[model samples]
Target: MARKHLVTHPSTAMMIRDTKAAEVAVLEHHERLDGSGYPRGLASADITPMGPILLLAEAFAYWDQLKVTLSPGTAKALADSAFAFADSCLLALQKALIDASPHTTPAPG
Candidate 1:
């Protein structure tokens, strides 16, 4: 199934509520940071914040579905291949995770 199908699929209609953010995230999910993706060629700042998050999650899910055991290095490689701005997105994700972790202590600046 094509990436656009995820946005227009009948099942998704029921599962996804009517919200601008939700719509943007779903519609832009397949968009790439380099403007090489389908449906719309959004590059860099043109892509919504949620778009990259969804893309990253989708990439990991795809690999997981294939039973690929992704070590940190493998995951980083995969993200680099899948996203043009993978380093920035990965860093942001890591920061988000660290901030959310109860056991994490703020790093000395």
Candidate 2:
């Protein structure tokens, strides 16, 4: 988690113009409800709203790259885990994938 703190140091935070939004986004991206994530080891309510969204997006992309396919099932599996992701973000991702699929009819949101 040292890396996390490094990003917010006076020298580093200045690089981001000391914007609270940017700082929080960077911190929350690695935070998890299970307290297994890095930097602050924050859990549940401590995490910002954008945190889960960024985590989900990164996880989905990484999983797709590693597996050589973007599997909606994998997205659902990750979202359904105990990571404490926002339900709305998961639902949005699901709807997006469904809408993009040629065979599956996009469910109403």
Candidate 3:
């Protein structure tokens, strides 16, 4: 079966083959900075870089939802709080992307 097709049905895939990546992602999902994470209970340093990025993305999405009922500033504030928990490297990369983004307004003439 194709990867995309299998992904559409998680249970079927689980019954059919090993779910190593899924298991690892789940382990990483509940991971924390205080060594309270699940599966292996990996801490901040123990978790890989990808874990924090996932956590940040989840926070940002939830923040966007909060924006629906709150002010834009409030939403941005929530997003910033989410960013605060991320690795500095991720924040720097995000800043670089924002600085270099084509959607950024050009300098005034």
Candidate 4:
């Protein structure tokens, strides 16, 4: 509700709505691994384009959060442990697809 209220006008809403439309193609899956449906009831499919990836990123971030900087062994260890937790969340299957890349977009070539 609050999120909706934030963009209670046209310009912002149209952009968000259209972006979601484009995202539909990317998120155009529904069949939950446990058997579900689409739209307002989506699960696995919702996670396809960006949802699952978000989860993975958050998990890695959880690890990254353990330290202030990405330095030597400590940083790497935190990452490893965070990923280990992310792995556990996916129960191994989903872990393989996870990416450890930063959330920021890459610069142009």
TM-score of each: 0.62, 0.58, 0.44, 0.28
Candidate 2 lDDT over residue span 10-83, tens digit each: 34545776468656766678777787777788887788776777677776676444543435675567667766
Can you write out model 1's per-residue Cα lDDT over 1-109, one digit (the tens) per residue?
5654865743464566666677777777788877888678888778888877877677655654554544557447756764664676666554544444454478999
Per lDDT, what order, best first? 1, 2, 3, 4
Alpha-carbon error at 106 in model 4, in Å?
Answer: 24
* Candidate 3: Cα lDDT at 37: 50
Regions of candidate 1 where Cα sits further than 4 Å from its true position: 4-18, 91-109
Q: Clashes in candidate 3: how many?
A: 0
Between candidates 2 and 3, the one scoring higher on TM-score is 2
Top-TM-score structure, candidate number: 1
Better of 1 and 2 by lDDT: 1
lDDT (C-alpha, whole model) for all candidates: 0.66, 0.65, 0.51, 0.40
> Over the stretch 57-108, how does candidate 4's per-residue lDDT look in tens digits?
5444665454223334543463354232222444432333234324457899
Whole-structure CA lDDT of model 3: 0.51
Best by lDDT: 1
